[model samples]
Target chain A: MFAGGGKTVFYPKKCPRVRPAPCEFPIIGVPTGEPLCTIPSGYRPNRKCTYMDYAIETNHLSKNYGQVCAVDSVDLHVQPGEIYGFLGLNGAGKTTTIRALLGMIRPSSGSVQVLGQPVGPNGRGPWRRIGHMVESPAAYPELTVLENLEIARRLQGVTDKNATLRVIEQLGIAAYRNRKAGTLSTGNFHRLGLARALLHQPELLILDEPASGLDPAGVVEIRELITRLAREQGLTVFMSSHILTEVDRIATRIGVIHKGRLIEELEADKLIEIRARRLEIKTRDLAAAQCVLSEAGYAVSANEDKLSTGDQRAIDAPEEVATLLVNAGTPPTRLAVEQENLEDYFLRLTGETI
Target chain B: MNTFIASFWAESLKVRRSLITLATAGGFMLLPIVGGLFMIILKDPENAKNLGLISTKAQLVGGVADWPSHFGILKTGMAIAGFILFSIITSWVFGREFADHTVKELLALPTPRTVIVASKFVIIGLWVLLLSILIFAAGLIAGWLVDIPGWSSALLWSSFGSYMLIVGLTYMLMPVAALIASIGRGYLLPLGWTFLAMALAQILGVLGWGEWFPWTVPGLLSELTGPSVEALGIHSYMVVFLTFVVGLSATIIWWRSADQSR
Candidate 1:
């Protein structure tokens, strides 16, 4: 079962009823008339499908450094085939959470389970099936790109001799294969990091900032590669990034973390509906528009050169707003409804302004 | 075993590509070359003085010019120089991971951290062993080239046995350097520890307690202070062995349990 939009949507195995009937359970994010208990036609069961719960799961996980709370009581659940975008500003404990998930750091409290195995006590976990790039890319500077990945392949216990070449090609780093890792550019360096992470065809990938240090084209290329891998190979990705636009573009599920706490978790599509929308009317006389909207029971505020309102009436019927403004001798020059973007939503939730 | 092999291969590649390997080899080779130079100076002091090799006040450099003296120089040099050089090798092998920020890559791999640490130790061991061999082999060639009088095979085998024992004792102390490198997460701390250990060894040897101290025991075994029969006992070797065990265990445990934020 998966939780989305404050409602639990059961997968096929979790549904109590055998026959397909109208879902008695409340449906929030699921489309109307869509079968609640049927698997998608393209869904193929893999080794990770046996877990059927979460690719990564954490409950009230917390970590501290002396008196400073690095990560506090954070809960995360990332389903298989879902691209979970962990969004936060710098020093927001995004890396701490990733470290805990990878068993690189022990949690001060609570537990973490990855690939259905508990993490830590002694850095023990299902690491063989998980690939990760923490903080930044790192490699033996003396080794070539091919040599670095070859070492990674061997350390990962991958027997296939061609795994290194496969990931190198997959990541479009074939051109720099023989070049020493220390000499690569930042974008190619990040590609090498991703190549190492993807070398073993891991079931889950935990990347700290997958698109960081890449040009716009490189970012788009990586985005397409990740999306393709997730769709075609059923790989789960848990990535943390401050780049809201990149997350907005690719993440199936978004988790916004602020000051070490996970403030919000929501499906990407549902974000479009949940984010606040407002109607803005730019008129010759902003004061007159504000007065008219306020008098008509529409809560309005003057913002710069425009009168903005969150009133449903104004948003649902923009022509009515235009007519009222026209009749009030403050005819609208421009009027449109604008939905808040992820960045705005994040800032607003965190009580920050940009 | 398979994981160990893979980790060993990875570690070997890192060492093979590093300039430190060549640098340490060259550094260790200096001991034999200097010893050879000292032998040439000792063999003909007046001629050496005429050639401006030694000052008039520095005419005597202890023992007579012979194979025993050359082998003695090699043994004592291994005891002293080997401590510094082997510590450097150990520090580089362990500390470079943290310095390069590649420790994180090793931490979460299928090959257990223990195996990786073991592979690092093994690489350091093999590297230092090779350097010791180079010093001994070069010392033999230098002795033959200088034409020192004493060339008895019996004395050569006995000196060789004692030289190897000193090398082993010096090698045993390196795990402490490894441990310090791991805990400090870089090269500086272990190198600092090495210098401290050397100072303490010198001070303790002067204070007449060298036999009990692990750092000083290797020097005593080399008979640099005096004859090993009078300077050391069974307890000295035991202390060095204990230091090795403690350092190796602590390093492995630290790698296994510590929070690797890097």
Candidate 2:
């Protein structure tokens, strides 16, 4: 759906596909039911855009083993050049969904589509255009890092032999290229896994727990690399991770899954919008502070050693809360506004509060 | 074709870099060396007595010091020991992927899972065949060193044919080990399967039903106890062939259908 009714096509003059006449645009389906812009034909088309603006789309995708459902009816839409962070706890169906998307497991019901092609039975899909690493980083322990990547590159149908060398340098594992994979440290092993995923210069990268063993610096490096791939190359990334802060920092959009179901999905900016913030106050007489804030029409509760209110009025004006507590003879000892971080939000959503 | 080549290369590299390769080679080398030792022990009874219990055991095991008896030792060794060694090779080829957790990396790729599985089988076949040839050559060298009597071109040709046939039959049974390794996803189950098969082969062969059982066919053909064609027939070959087909098809189906949640 590139052009709407009676709307003139807006073609960029500098577009590489600009011809002497007019550039032809194809009408494609997007989940949002809106028209999408067109890129040059030779350029990697929006991987997320087929009939929809989604590189990966699933409808009622569910997988059950015997009586237990590993992945419930989950709907996902990952747009091109957008890093969609799948946040979940362990056994939360993140890996199951990733496996289904890659066609590693047959869904008990529903379907999955990637890069505009349905993932066929027995793990057949548009794999040439998609790169992925599921679960743990795995390599032939007896083979060197370079050898392992060379295999991945070849199996990925990459013609250039130098791709292995390029990815090795790109992941900063050049020193260990000649070292056997079994000898690598955990972080470097993860880098080798990432290098393998990026070996074919795929348009879509699906990774599960990609940062599991990386140190803080390595995490940052991978984040920056993913960000650059999405920004500069228009790559689509669908990644799952338990590390909420890491996902929050790099993902354009995030989906939280709990107990084999997709519970929540939102833009990264909206994470702050939904996160619960509060005005917390400490006083000599907590009950008195609670009464005073209650009298001011703010819903207050006594929690542990303090009185807290989740009202925006109290949060925006903590000084007013302090003054009200003082006039009521509570004499506030401490008063401050606090906001919940992504981890807290995630924990609360998953009903695993700390 | 490109994906096939790539997958073949990957499987070959893993096989080449593995210690199992050298380990299996060294293990098979024992067959010829032990055969040569038996010949030396059988050559002279007085010297054999001076050599202690080893000579007595060799005399009991090997009847006479000659090219026929020596070749018989080689044939019997390949038939019996080949089962264990070839099963170990098949187990390592398939099981090591799961042991190393590298199977996941192989699951979703431009190369089909069937191609990867086929490449592994091809590598195993080539490796087992090469080892068979190597051990046969070693046996010939050992026979020449011992300078056993009854050496003739006709005997050599007959012995070589027998050696190759027994080795082939042993190799034919190894795909079952591959299937077991794939289903069990590690070394233990396949090794267990090999031992169980060997035990059952012995019992079945003793029960006078060796021809019908695929595992017993190799041992019967090797004729370690003496030529007893009454317990075996042409159906024995058919049974072994069917077992191979079944094991191979089951392995491919498992790779294609099983949920690789691990």
Candidate 3:
């Protein structure tokens, strides 16, 4: 039924992440193949264009499979040299979002700007600067680890064999360089994939589920490598993952996608703000706790031994929670407070309380 | 250029994992050796008299087959067995990728889709060429023991030009295997489909034009049979080459269009 990639599908007007007003920036810069960086007057280019600063920016992007919307008019902006974590649950369109960004499939409607250029832009030059290993550890099994890196390295125009070998060892796969990629263990396969991805030292790396089949130790090793690349090498990384801890640990900024739409785009610090207010209290007169919290503009939800207010400004949660109960003739038992982290924010943004 | 070489090297490595390809080569080498043994057996005077051949040690032990088929055994056995071996090895080239779920890795590479498709064709072409050489070499080796005359090294090498023209036709078998591999879920379906197509070509061949028919050409070319010896020509080479290029190009383009990337 799908042929010619014909008849662009229309989506509804509800674009949750669209900016109220389009911001136009001066197109003056060192021209480096950004899709929208410069457009000649009186000439029409392809559908995709380059954005001035954002490595990737998608406006109203959506992909619907039958009645089910796999990506629902999601908007995303990833800056260069920043590791942005795409956090989501299973079936949350994390992979779909990554796929659309990479031009792996056509969007039903909307636009995608990748590596500062609109996806499918003229010349296809920007892709040469981008490296991606998607969904699984994708590499040629028939090739040795070094051979796989060599192919990618040559394509990306990196002339130094020593540089590729440097990355191979950096990824801790030098010992397995001669082994067939298909014969390596799952974790080693991932290491080899990473070595290939970093061969050209690509400016932007889009890794979908980067830690597939890695153990905790392997994840730590990978996480450390990612941190070094982002911080030391200034390589921008866009990673999608189902694991909350991985996202929390490495993402410079976090975008949680759920059911193909973006649940929220906030800094990792912001999510911790949402879930981190761990309130420990010293009180027994639980009856007045709600009234006391409400008096101070705190919306409190109480379930037996505990009560939580939704926001930080609502109360100095612990102090307010305790003072109210103690003043109502009940001396408290204990009180403590901690801010929300990625896990709490992840659950809150997806609206799934686990 | 480096990219092409790297990919070519990568694909050649994939063959090691497939026992079918190994078996195909092994069987081809064994065929000539076994034929020599059979000639050795026939010279024992029991079977030689039945075939009505004169028994000079020289004439009886000629190249693996040593002489003409008694309208029965040698030619039929060699053609059928050789064709089956090529088909068997050819069946696995594209078929195994879908079976093992490794096509995903292939399509995801950043290179153009055409490059990926051509890599498989290069591999298949190489195998077909190598197998043709082994077959020709086997005949010469067996012919040695019998002291058969007219073992022209010149004719054998030049015959390859004609063989490759037909070899061009045989290239489609891989892409057809690739097409089935694309749509069908596993190795068995592509293998079954390839085997069925070859069988159908045979059924059609029985009607009249089977020997010169495009699909059956590889079998006949491998045999270098009676009428085929005269019918095989420079023009036949071009026809097979054109047919093969058209068929393979169509299959590869269709394969490139499919949404195989995961």
Name the runs in model 2 displaced over 4 angstroms.
A1-52, A283-285, A316-319, A329-334, B225-227
**Top lDDT hit:** 1
Q: Residue B7: error of model 1 in Å?
A: 0.8
lDDT score for candidate 3 against the true structure:
0.63
lDDT of 1 by residue, A1-354 (tens): 343444333232223222223223332122223333443444334422332356788999999999999899999988766899999998899999999998888899989988777888465887788899998899998899999999999999999999898899888899999999999998899999999999988878999988887899889988998888877666788999998889988899999999999999999888889899999889888887888888888999888988888999889999998898888888999999999877788889888877
Candidate 3 docking category?
Answer: incorrect
Lowest summed lDDT across 10 adjacent residues in model 2 chain A is found at A9-18
CAPRI-style quality class for the chain A–B interface of candidate 2: medium
TM-score of each: 0.91, 0.91, 0.76
lDDT of model 2, residue B14: 82
Could you report the Cα RMSD, in angstroms, for every candidate shown?
A: 5.1, 4.4, 8.7
Ranking according to TM-score, highest score first = 2, 1, 3
Sorted into a CAPRI-style docking class, model 1 comes out as medium
Candidate 1 lDDT by residue in tens digits, B1-262: 3999999999999999999999999998998897887788788877767856353422444346788888888988888889999999999999999999999998888889889988998998888888888889999999899998988999989988988888888888988999999989999999999999999988888788899899998788777653344778888889999999999999988988888866
Candidate 1, superposed: residue stretches over 4 Å from native: A1-52, B50-61, B225-229
Give native contacts recovered, as a fraction, per prediction. Answer: 0.72, 0.71, 0.10
Candidate 1 chain B weakest lDDT stretch, 10 residues: B53-62
lDDT of 3 by residue, A309-335 (tens): 645654454555566666766656755
